[model samples]
Target: MAFKENYDSGETELKSKTSQDSPIHCSIDEDHPCDDGLPPIDGGRHAWLFLLASAMLEALVWGYAFSFGIFQKYYSTHEPFQGSNNIAAIGTCAMVGIAYLIAPLPIIGMILLPQIARWVSTIGVILMCVSLALSSFSTSVTHLILSQGIGFGVGGSLAYTPSILFMSEWFVKRKGLAFGVVWSGSGLSGVLFPLAIEWLLDRYGVPTTLRISSVGLFLLSIPFLYFHRPRIPVSHAVVQRRLNFRFLYSKVFLIYQIGNTVQALGFFLPTIYLPTYASQMGVNELLSSLTVILFNVTSVFGSIIIGFLSDRYHVTTCLLITTAGSVISVFFIWGFSSNLWSLYVFCIVYGLLAGGYSSTWSSIAHEVQHANPATDFSVIFPFMETGRGIGNVVSGPLSEALLKADGWQSHAWGTYGSRYGTIVLWTGITALIGGIAVMARYLKCV
Candidate 1:
């Protein structure tokens, strides 16, 4: 009923009969689809190019955020920022947390100023370069926070939001696979950037390293803006479509959001601390960094696999796979680890499982759109990202508290006596709770 009303009012033409009794209605005509004079959907030269550029942009924007563990370790031991409490995690979280938090702004802009949607991404790229360049001059941890944290975060969100909005236009049938490929950019970059950053920090020091990265990012991003343009034109009338809020009232969305939020609370803990943990086990710096590399490399394949799964299976089913695998890895592999080899195993397993969960957003977005086509991917994704961002915002303080807790120190269970017990247990518990989203389907709440 809602879909029919929304479609009838919009620019789309309907092909099927609109009977009140029909449970399923085709909102758009397949025979005479709304013609915006664009390339074909799902597969086309422009579509593939756009997906490629988007994936690269994803790498450039999120790669640094994903590799923050290396920076965290570097800052904690280096001069200037050394001995600063939680300063490392603060910068890392700021960049990632703010990026997720501000996702809604670009979507809102698309609604209010549809004509400018194309340029928003360009502006975001400029902001990201400027932020990184400005960060090169930092003499204190606070400066890094302002530049790399807030500046990069804002820039990344600006650049990334448009991609999410445009994706639905390009690939309706294979949206999940498209999203997976785009998301894999981060995993690919995650594998490479950690090694590169570590080498740069070792040879060039922080200021030079930051400046070099700034220039490199600028060079890498500018060319891709050409390919990231929207496939369909957003007319004034299209922008005027009434925003759908029905999904918010659905029990399914509420349950999924809660689980996603809880999972996020501990999702970043291992990423932030894995290298340091490996070092504590007497592993060399290069080897410590290798842990992150392995995690990210495995995640690249994992994202593609999970994305394919999401396309075929229910979102809740995919969530269960990630949740169960992540919980098992954290509790069994990471918890009882007494050596670097065990930590390496944990990284690979966790990366393959938890790292792919973000790809499931495509499925969730599809589900929401099916219920209300008036609601675009932009609407659903920003809300889900906001949930994850909340968890990232608090993870630094939460991790510190968990690591310092004396109660968990004396326990003989797993790695409880190694000062990392609380963090391990917390990651496992949160992951388990995140699986509660699956219950929604079973209870017929969806």
Candidate 2:
């Protein structure tokens, strides 16, 4: 008789190994004889200090990310470079590189432990500050790409990673609440920074605006760097030898991996195009910029509320609610709307829902991992971020293609007519797909 393989034993073992929710990861949390990885989040002096400092750091880096729409509007409409939406988007693409692109390295570093990652990331701040200062002098996109995109992207990712690492370590039971506060910094930035940049751009021009932002980013980096300590006791020297491929073969993680891939394609299109759409509506460019600010402001409150609710209620349902809100807001309200008020209404509703989904990443990721899922998070979050990055890039060219076909930019709504409705229609479909995946994949819970 031919020798039989051990496939049946492995299949039975793998299913038993996964968490109660779904078969996403071969969770060692069940039998791994070890200390629970996270540290206490007692409101100690150090914790509060680090939290406040972290909040400021988040405010600067993410503020820039959220307010890119304001910059997009200015660049698209202003002289010397009255460019199309695609060209203007390159700057924000730099921001995307930091968030979606650089997600992995730091997670790897965070996994190794605190000391090495923390000190290494501190050096990242200097690199970012210098890039901002250098980019201020740049006139060409290549220069911005080099100084802002490459240098700042590298630095910002380093700085931002620790904030995430620390959140997992410090706040366990209250992780959702703490995460809501930390992530809400972007919404705060979205609210205030864009409006401020508009004034600075009008008064000082793009170059000057960049210089000012760099100085502020650099200053904010200091206090946070001083206080960010890791509470988790991770061993850097141990070579966690796991030759078994059992954990890699899970159904739940596979589904989320697939879900994240589809969702990423159209996520940022609204933040990127809202101002352009406003301009198309014959709204003043300055007021158009305010649309982003308003959305972000609304997001600040929305994130906190949603995050709190997720802890009490079902996270998957919360995700569905947000996804459904985004689809309806985009396809029906944003797609058909012509005037400023209708579009603005859509933006506010969308912003609130959008904020809910964005801030919940940490909680959902952690909860899915449940009491102990270090490995699951290590595996999944990067894939989700990768999906988001691809989604952002895809949307840019997509907007360009639709605009070329429709000549919507030159039509009555100006740039808005050419692209806004198209973006809403496309992104809504993708978000709906995300909702379907969420419903089907997590339906047992619902």
Candidate 3:
């Protein structure tokens, strides 16, 4: 009855008729069938080129935020903002956190005013660059928070949301892989930027590094706009379908989002704390930075692999795979790590598992869209990202509290003996809770 009702509404639907069935079916956009003379859905020169540009833009936009651990390390020890409490909040909560939180706004705007998508993206880039430039002039932590944290977060949200919208239009069958390729850019840059930022911070200090970064990103991001057009013509989108929120009440989305939010709570903990943790362990600064690099490098591959697998498997299967690996890395590898070898192992293992978590979102969208065909990916995707943002905003302060909490330390050896032990346990527990969706799946709640 529901599918017939959705079919009458001229909305797209997956070939599979039921939610219990695997979503590995042809996604038919009944509103714009193949005879419509539009560009091909999955594979075309324009599509691949667009995907490449999106990936590169993803790297440029998110790379800096991903590499904020280096900035966090620098701010804790350097002049001006040194000895300031909650320095971690600038990167985790203000920049990345706020971006994820407010991302739905620009996306909502784009849905309403599809014609201005390119201009919005351009404005977002300019805002991000300007934010970085303003951050260079900061003399206090508050200034950095406003400029780098809030300003860049707002700008990045504007610039990035259009890609997600256009991307949904560009590739359907291979949407998971498309998202994987695009998201890998963040991890790819994560590999390169940490070393580069560390070098610049050491050589020219924070102001010069921030200024140079702002200029470099502006030049790099501008060219990608050429490839960022929507696969569907905007004139067709002018119909302005009513926004749907029925899927929000579904058990399937709720279960997956609970897992997603819980996972995000601990997802950023390692990236935010790893460099400083290594430096405190008597590792050289270069080696300390290398930890972030290794983590990001594995994530690049992890995203691609998980994306590929998601296309062929169920979303819960993919979620469980990533979750199991992540929990193991946190509990066994990171918890006992007292040396570079074990720490490096944790970064690689954890990055591969958890870094690929976001890539599974496309599949989640697919599943949710199946249940509520009238709801578009544009609606579901932003809400999913907002869920993650909830965790990201809380993680910075939560991590700080865990680090400062007393009675967790012991007169022993390894990570359990150190002040970081509580942090490690918290990370593991949250990661474990993040897998709760699998149980819900087994229980037939969906």
Candidate 4:
């Protein structure tokens, strides 16, 4: 591990000379262009390009997951293997669930077995890619359960964690914007993939679409693989220490972690259920699904705006404001939405809040991990990604239970007339919980 240097001792001073960063990070060396101690890159056109690429990669990875709701609708009804969301979730949950469980595996390897962890981790990625391609031909639930649950989930983990780690390492001052831009991939995917996948699914059957999408996911990793490199290398010395849960025990960190996990329990439910909820509310299928698009579109701006805020405002304050706003927007706007128009309003608002939720992950990570904004963020970034992966996996099952109240063909949640209302309620509660985390930090109540 690098020795901890105080902010003043000219070590950090070297930061400003190289990049708009602290001495801890120099981003411009030939061998490690991202980490070689270059000066910080200001947020501008070059920065925006980085954002765009990050968004594209994210759209492919995170967006695909968000769009699974669209596929979920198709899977639930039209097959020789027709099933409920709960039933179908075995594959989805396993993919996501295993993704979470394996996160610290490599980190742990770094501590226990340095030499083989790197190559073995890459092999895991190979296995993950194979998992999806195999899912296309499955005829039974077990096929998907094994193929997607184990293969794709683990594969995505290996691929995604590295990209995020690289991005954090590469951009310091602009980390929020960079993360925000990449973070928007989830939003962008929500916008683009659903429409694309829906068309492909309708034109080709699920089996064919899965095959194509698997190939697409495989191909999609190339750009990230080629362009994304770690700014700073993880040192063998750094790996000598055991996995520390000290951060997990920190007041602010715990608040953020648990709150985020709880929020995620429902944060994505809206994206997954909005289209179905719309159809149940008597909206047309085409229009119903478009809500996902509209919601994602609005989220793009929200992410950019929040990225701006996170850099300009205090991270805790920015998180508090966004979380509070999200609670209000989801609870009142999405909670009571009754018609297509109401949902439309809800989508834009909710989309923006959703975007904010993601943009903060990196910025807050920097603060909590105490890494310089411009230095290699590789040290801290993966932990947050792990936190989020856990959040994503848990959100699925909890939301599936709430979403079921409306049923596939009906709008009522058992006796209640609001499926979306129930969905919104879940997010609102979780969001408020996240807000409490921020507030606890500010007030030192934690």
Question: Please, what is the whole-model Cα lDDT of each candidate in the order they appear?
Answer: 0.81, 0.65, 0.84, 0.63
**Candidate 3 lDDT, 276-377, residue by residue in tens:** 989998989899998899999999999998998988999889889999999899988888888988999999998898889999999998889888877777
Global local distance difference test of model 4: 0.63
lDDT: the better of candidates 2 and 3: 3
Model 3 weakest 10-residue run by lDDT: 18-27
Candidate 2 lDDT, 242-295, residue by residue in tens: 111233445554455455545655667777777877776677767788778778
Question: How close is every model to the real structure, measured as TM-score?
Answer: 0.91, 0.81, 0.92, 0.79
Error of 3 at 75 (Å): 0.5
Best by TM-score: 3
Of 2 and 4, the candidate ahead on TM-score is 2
For model 1, residues 1-446, the per-residue Cα lDDT tens digits are 99888977663432333322111122222233334456777788999999999999999888878888888898889898888776745544688888887787788787678779888888988898889889888878788888988899999889888888788677777888889998889999998899999999999988888888888988888889899987766555444343456777776677878888888889988888889988887878899998889888888888988999998899989999999999999999999987888888999999999989888988887676676666656678778888788878777678888877857675665575678898999999999988887777788776
Model 1 CA deviation exceeding 4 Å by range: 1-37, 240-242, 372-374
lDDT of 4 by residue, 244-277 (tens): 4466555556666776667666666676777777
What order do candidates take by TM-score, descending?
3, 1, 2, 4
Once fitted onto the true fold, the runs of candidate 2 whose alpha carbons sit more than 4 angstroms away are 1-42, 84-86, 237-249, 367-379, 407-418, 442-446
Q: Candidate 3 — which pairs collide?
A: none
* Deviation in Å, model 4, residue 387 alpha carbon: 3.3
**Residue 223 lDDT (model 2):** 65
Best by lDDT: 3
